[model samples]
Target: MQRVKAVICYDGTHFSGWQVQPGKRTVQQEMERALTRIHKGEHTPVVSSGRTDSSVHALGQVIHFDTTLAVPEDRWPKALNQLLAPDVQVMETSFVDSSFHARFDAVEKTYRYRVHLTKERDIFRRHYVYFYPYPVRVEDMKQAAPYLTGTHDFSSFCSSRTDVTDMVRTVHEITVEEDGDELHFTFRGSGFLYNMVRIMAGTLLEVGKGLRRPEDMPAVVEAKNRESAGNTAPGHALYLVEVRYE
Candidate 1:
């Protein structure tokens, strides 16, 4: 069998999520379905770097699977793209070492949350960017973001329903960048808990609005309570930018 690795980009607007669920459309299910048809009735399983919530998009999500077919690596993507739904596209494909794993081997991940600041939301970009027409101090959000970097127990930022007992993760960096009428919150980390990035966006947004002190961000991290953090931002504006493996 050949171990194949591929990078896929998907518009998650209509997906239930990445994983397969009964009676639901999902990225994983579609990927596996395409592979099943290629294998002529045999079941095939695909594993991903991580999961993205419904309405969340991806640009460089990684996945792997073992296949018996000896199809040329260059042709794999072309074969799959013909079968994948329009919203999910296989961008790159290649063979990898048999021991490589998409999830456990990933050493870093980058996520971005986009916010469009305008008096009126753009109907064309409505599903891609979060629209906020209110006044916000970008400097305030920048000042408060530093406290969220480095290794810490991120219990306050993740969802309370997360099954992860170890909430500790290293956030390598957090940058808030402005481009014209848009604000981008880019987060690079070792990994993230469920809803962690969205919560961080929400908390920093609160800081921008003068609802939270910039210097008090450390205390919020120390609190380690979900209630102590800000609200969870919506998923539609979040994108899985990249996943890295070493």
Candidate 2:
């Protein structure tokens, strides 16, 4: 058996997230179905680097699968794209050592959140950006971002629905940039808890809008309580930008 690594990009507008559910349409389900067809009815499982929530898009999601087929690496993307839905595409593929596991081998990940700060909504970007019309003090958000960076218990920003007890994660960076009426928040970290980025974005947004003080961020992180954080932003605005591996 050979392990194949593929870089995937998807719109995530209509699917039920990356993982396969009993009856829901999902990115993994579509990928596995295509692989199954490629192997002539044999089931093949594709493992992703991480699970993204419903409506959360991806520019560089990575996955790996073991296959017995002899398809060439250069043709993998073309072959898979032909079978996948229009919204999901396999951008690149290559053979790797059998020991390379997409999830286990990942060393870092970057996620981007887009926020639209205009009074009128742009229908074209409605599916990709969070609409926050309230005036934001961008500098204040930047100041608060540093407090959330580095290693800490992120339980306050994680979703209560998650069962994972370990809330500690290292955030290498959190950058907020403004371009016209849009604010781009990029987060790079070792890993993230369920809904962690969204909650952090919401908390930072509160600070930006002057509803919360930037100094409160350190206290929020220290509290380790979900109630200490701000609201959880919607998932549609988040994008899994890239995953890194050593």
lDDT of 1 by residue, 70-178 (tens): 8999899999999888999999998999999999999999999998888898999888998888899999999999899999999999897767899999999999999
Q: Which residue runs does candidate 2 get wrong by more than 4 Å?
A: none
- Tens-place lDDT digits, model 2, residues 68-162: 98899888999989999999999999999999999999999999999999999999999999998888899999999999999999999988899
Error of 2 at 53 (Å): 0.6
lDDT of 2: 0.95
Best by lDDT: 2
Please identify model 1 stretches exceeding 4 Å from their true place. none
Model 2's C-alpha root-mean-square deviation from the true structure amounts to 0.7
**TM value for model 2:** 0.98
For candidate 2, the 10 contiguous residues with the lowest summed lDDT are 66-75
